[model samples]
Target chain A: MATGNISHGRILSIQSHVAYGYVGGKAAVFPLQCLGYDVDVINTVNFSNHSGYGRFGGSRASAQELSQIFDIMDQNGLLYPERLLTGYVPGAEATEAVTALAQRLRHRSPKLIYLLDPVLGDSGRLYVSPDVVPIYKNALHLATIITPNWFEVEVLTDTKITDAVSLRQATQVLHQTYHVPHVVISSIPLKSWLLDLLPAHLHPASASASTSEHLACIASSRQGSSSTVYATCFPCLPGYFSGVGDLFSALVLAHFTDEPTTEGETSLSRAVSQAVSKTHAMLVLTHEAAAALPEDERTVTDEELDVREPIRKIRRMRGRELRLIQGQDIIRGTQPIEFRRLQAWDTFWDA
Target chain B: MATGNISHGRILSIQSHVAYGYVGGKAAVFPLQCLGYDVDVINTVNFSNHSGYGRFGGSRASAQELSQIFDIMDQNGLLYPERLLTGYVPGAEATEAVTALAQRLRHRSPKLIYLLDPVLGDSGRLYVSPDVVPIYKNALHLATIITPNWFEVEVLTDTKITDAVSLRQATQVLHQTYHVPHVVISSIPLKSWLLDLLPAHLHPASASASTSEHLACIASSRQGSSSTVYATCFPCLPGYFSGVGDLFSALVLAHFTDEPTTEGETSLSRAVSQAVSKTHAMLVLTHEAAAALPEDERTVTDEELDVREPIRKIRRMRGRELRLIQGQDIIRGTQPIEFRRLQAWDTFWDA
Candidate 1:
């Protein structure tokens, strides 16, 4: 799966495009472009804003429309995309169209790297149609890299990820069952052992540990070799962000594709570390901007106001969209933040 | 029309989105976001590539689809866009739909600043359908700022723009006839006097003068006051470049809406000068990149190969798409380019 020294390659990104907020295509395109990749976006849905706002408006692109767009590209002999990225397709029909498009593109460019972010839902829920899950389960075999949240990993593998051991088992099932070469589980809830891997000074006190600490783990397996998994954890901001996963996946893709494979720091660990650091920096900036909003502007509904959890209260506040544009410097890597990497371990769960 | 010191306002951008090339929405969205504005984009057409390739693929968004998308936004109460920008609508139906959308948006928010880039054609040609012209003429009255090339100004005002005098007359007619307040006639063909207005060292000799030198002129007519026009000239790089106009309009809108009106530098002259400088910088970058391509990659058709004109020869060479993402630092204003402003003058042509 390793392609050597290809820079400035074209990326075919299929996702949703929102007019008012950062999510899906809106979240991914700008950051990838900032990293100097030519991104071709096929929007699965066009929405007025991210649904996290409690209100959103837009229409989904029909499967026929999607096919028509692809036909034009096919006719023009422009089908070779070095990487194909699938984000948020709304329904079963769009998902099928995207899968067919990806298969066709893969057939044309055999070395093409496909990264699928299985955006079904998060936090024990499914936002997309149930029919879409089967499509993703089948499409996982075609993906070179699969980025899913812990919940999505659980859903896809039909496993309960209660602890670190179960998480490892789920990843093993993903690799063995779907033949996915690389799996990156983003925003995974950190456990005690994972926290112990970090330097003592960076780790939060166990007494005050909350659900806000997260680790993003990247696992890769090769034939005739043991699977190796590396993880990096950063303190998650105390709120729900609409597009953090989208942004993180884009940054990882850009780093993994743009950097020379021969470089020592171009390993998966280093790329994940950089991606986590940037995502953390952006989150910090967005949180700060939200905190600075006028009290009236940050007002929440009565139901939200009664919530005791600080994270919940923060999530319900109005005008809490990610400050992506305001934090462009961080995306450009002009402003740097530190991220701590955990020790790499061999897969211990049975395959 | 004057709104002061509003930072990070939202912009509603209606334009064409191309998958493979930087033009229309593809060109405008990133730069505006880089400038720290929340941009909501409604793509008028989705194409495989810009038409400059001599052959391309794509489909236009139907009026019903546009209305459906807008309906969602309207239902969600997300209609207030600080600035509304229209670019590259392909047909009469889309034009009418956008006009109605703009009217509804303006009625809801009277302070909305509408900037219309009448992308009819260039170099004395009409690339869009003839029916679009009448639509544009009617829509012009609704725009606060109208950016048109000299050719478009001629078409809209029904007058030929031969000299600086006629150019002023054309703009005057635009203001009085259409009631547009701020008329920016981008890419006006420069005469000798206008060329003399540029710094002497930057000027080319009279013997080699062609239709390549263009002045970007901004004309403003406020009530009970004389019309004032300011112009700046940059040597237009040879060859057809797509999306320069779109990029220019986005930059202008960003500067106008983001910068503090009270600051001396935030005047219309400063905005136009900065926009032109950035556009020129990008053009220079693109031309250099095109020139550096391998000779085999620069091969052209037999008809193009026989052309003796250097500009024509350069235009015919293959692989000439704007290197926008590579040159994004200029858009971010990290690499500064200097542009000189010509003296301001009152309209001198008789109506």
Candidate 2:
């Protein structure tokens, strides 16, 4: 638990590397590192490529094999202080071990951030085996933050969040129901009641009628004195690299646990947001260049995707209060300002 | 069968819509038609994204539900496909139905090019469910051009192809074994084999000494003509995109089925190479862009992914008679070629 101070050693992330870079901790660990969080990953499955190709080395790990690594980590005292982030836990064995690991982490350091990128349905459909959702539901309470897309938010909260109000209602229920105070409903496509109060110029959703439909996406940075300067962004574009949630959570956990000097208003929200922007810029710039190249050159572009793009970089996390940015917010610099003030969402202590 | 010549007809192609666009005929289809093939597609499975995103809606396709579309097509006499291009046949039913359709087409026209992009494995690993590969094996004889990557080729030929000699030998066996004459091994990375025939100069197995040691990827346009000039190139970079096979097949089908006046060469090899260059360009233009965007905007660009981005446009199909490059080649392409050598692989009839 000593790692929880300024220099948190690393985060122990376990995932189903069933597909290559799209899911699991492969995508998550990188951005976390970018935000200064070291991550050690254990892949449950090493696929030739993702399953979508309909041609891959079928699932390789019996949950038992996957757990052996975790068991070793546990034996080595690695899990003690380091946070845990998991995505797409494949079989019953993986599910069983990960849930246990989460508990162990909690017992070891109640402050350990168990961030789960509950990669469930996107655009009204579930991607994981429905059988696994329940297991994921079980891990809900252990997580400090559960970042789900709209469909997942709906599933976790059992509420259909098709609109903004419902989304907020769902975010509340998600945090309330799961007790994971910080809830980020990524890709949520609507404006919220809170954004109405921020400067009309800073409300990004209002400026671009085109961008207003973005699903709700949140990343809280350092806890501050004045207020968590909640910031919000409309994904300037769509089709971002997969596995971004993993990255965002790792970033949030690193910044929060590190006790970084996120001045009052600027908070961890701003710092994480900048991390996200840096990751996004890295992905986007590479992708543009890749797009410029011939197909033969296409390869794994990012360890984690630029989940949110071109959003202003959040730097001064300590004291700056978050203000609403207009849809033109994307045109602004990359800075993470806590944008949303949800009684439901929290980065650290739930109470 | 008579409709094959109809520039615009519902070429009911069966493939998967890579929840995202890693596969299926999504982004590549438009570019293909831009190359000149009227294409209508049916997804065998609707995944959350590419299987690589861990998973989404675990490959759900009841045989009955999958066949409904084809059943309807049967009623409309549209089942008699002039050209059938297939990639990643999901389940037993899809494989059988497509095979049956291809068989019927051959029976009726004997000239129907069932260009099968045998998507089974890559780099010596299988991604398809066990049940699917065997079915594909059975259907291989029904395809004219069996385009397999290095791994799939090895699986089918049972020959460990190392150098150009082995490749040539393997091609013959593949042609003989699968009953197809044209065996296009995409992106062969061996630099020695690729002296003049260059592109995707990706060398899969070269030692570190002056060897890229990257996968040898070949983007080629094959024509069924006397002077077969394969326009082979490597992206000269390292990356992996799953649905690339689907796009390649679509490109080959598009190029050979049309006539043109673009350049000097008049051969199937050149034609296939041209398709490879064009497809490579489209992939290059879209791949990283997709990496940068979310699930949707990946295909649509900041402006437009001009299929005419120098590399994407097919100025002409060389190596036989006519060497003309038309918009149909770039604006609306994606059907079988005018010649018929590759068909030998897809069918067991008189080659």
Candidate 3:
């Protein structure tokens, strides 16, 4: 309210709500709000915690319930949100409902930017129902910005990404096939040569050469202009983080919505850069906290690190959650953005 | 995570979550998170917006579903949250489930603090089901802190609060009969005589003589010591505002949990003072925003300002929501707390 003339953008975020841990809406909403967006979250699933803990509690909201909520919003004449973000829709029905909602919202508000986070799975598999892939692919046309990790990209485009060239090709194919103006691949595995080509400071000494690190790439293409792709590689974190993608999507959207595309600065690239920098800072904070845990609580065995669980074993062993609250200052910009921007094309594999 | 020695406290908040408005958990969770607490929220109902717009859509979680969620948390060994909060339980079954959950959590962790916001009604009428009142009364013993408005106090204690003396007596009865150590009467209507007893500067020039204003009071009793009661008065902003109570409860809990009851500062009074100050600032922001709207959008007919609707007409008239995100800096303490602590007893009506 202190902001007199400056209008805070409204974001309607549809995602999961975990009572305990940070995932989906729980992870996304806070950061967006911290960044000064008026965020309205529609949780597709309400659980006691993220399911990564082997056992969890809560219920997935029925599509009918979602429709009812949407209807109510419509009745209240609250249909036109500045932006709409969809994350972690549980099943085919939820996916259909969300897609329909997005399309209707897009029709209602032409400027309503849709940021779709395709949350199928990480690694080379599908954690969600097989039916969800086609639904996501179909929903891609509605999204102004699409954020998918490597595995989701593969699932959506039906292409394997073995190296940098293939990753660029896949991203290109996504733009050509789906007409998505902005594509942000959240975590693409980096090859050894690519890692060696980068600056040494990017990789911490603790990061071993044997393990693959990840690069988050953002690609934007206009109709007549050549496309610009920007990418940044971060040190391979020791643990699996469940809500990092959600956090990234939220931050990117926040930046994009907060600052419009100007002649001097490409808003998409700037947004991605800011988001990656913030996420890297948050991960460093998370890693430091995990490393500081008592020895008895520090190490998690391979068996306990179940692939089925959404969170990583190391996180469970350390604090069993993302350190969102503790690292909030970073999210709010009180802590400076420490991660530097790499030359946009220099890190691009195709270049 | 950056705070090496400080451990962020955890709060399990059970409340309603509106997708498009600030009320219940939607109003509570972000402020607590902004203050650096790791908050887990269980939403009782997921409405599109607050019901104050004459219509709303959402489904309330059944008791069975609530039990299932609790069972999952218990199975995962996550039942020992440092604090538990309950707000806006839609039905008796949900109330019973929450009470049981609180008792079980309290048993698991004896140090667990339960802050119960008895969100039954305000301004002398019951908005919720009548059955919820008895359930709330039965559950009062399980709470460490109970925040209720004047109407709720009267309903719970079966007494009329004509003046400050009666209000104190009612709070004492709550402590004696229900064993609640902390009783915070959120809003007590002040009489004209009481207003004259206060310093003139506390009341703004716009606050007319005929219109009644409210004061927020906190009464705390220790086992062997006499009770300490504190009160602060503010000009009543024109228009109805929902979620103010939920926001107050959250800020109080955040402050109380953040700072222990040390010798130099009474944590209860400090928490109440801070919460009152923050709420007043937010209301001021809300009033400014509402007043800035075009005249056509400014006025809400008296009939439209229904007491059954939890939020204010001004909010609905302008943005159709509370200005929670706009005034978030106050919630995060970046903005200075402006309202000072009034002479605790000068504002007392009986004096």
Candidates 2 and 3, the one with greater TM-score: 3
Per-residue lDDT for B1-351 in model 3, tens only? 133224468899999988887889988998888777888788898888777776788889989888888887776666667988899987899889998998888777777788999998999989898888888998988888889998999999988877546665787778888888888888776676445554565553456555375553544544433365565676677667888999999988887744456552466777887788898888888778877776655666466454654234423543535688888877766677685453344334343
Clash-forming residue pairs, model 3: A1-B326, A52-A310, B240-B312
Residues A1-351 of candidate 1: C-alpha lDDT, one tens digit per residue: 211112377899999988767889988998888777888888887777777655566678888888878877776556678998889998999899999998888888778988899999998999998899999999988888888998899899999887656766787788888888778887766666655443454454354656246554554543333466665456666657779899988887876744454433335656666677788888887778877887755655455453453334334433566777777767767654665443455434333
Worst 10 residues of 2 chain A by lDDT: A315-324
Model 3 lDDT on a 0 to 1 scale: 0.76
Q: lDDT tens digits, residues A81-192, model 3?
A: 8999999988999899999999999888778889999999988878799998899989888888888988988988888877656666787777878878888887776667
**lDDT per model, in order?**
0.74, 0.49, 0.76
> RMSD in angstroms, all models?
5.3, 18.1, 4.1
TM-score of each: 0.86, 0.40, 0.90
Ranking by TM-score: 3, 1, 2
Q: Model 3 — TM-score against the truth? A: 0.90
Candidate 3 chain A TM-score vs. reference chain A: 0.87
Error of 3 at B304 (Å): 7.1
- Find the candidate with the highest TM-score and give its number: 3
Candidate 1 per-residue C-alpha lDDT over B139-189 given as tens digits, one digit per residue, 9 for 90 to 100: 888898888988999999998876656666677778888888777877776
Q: Per-residue CA lDDT of candidate 2, range A89-109, in tens?
A: 666566877788788778788
Better of 1 and 3 by lDDT: 3
State interface RMSD in Å for all models. Answer: 6.8, 20.4, 3.6
DockQ winner between 1 and 3, please give it. 3
Name every residue pair that clashes in candidate 1: none
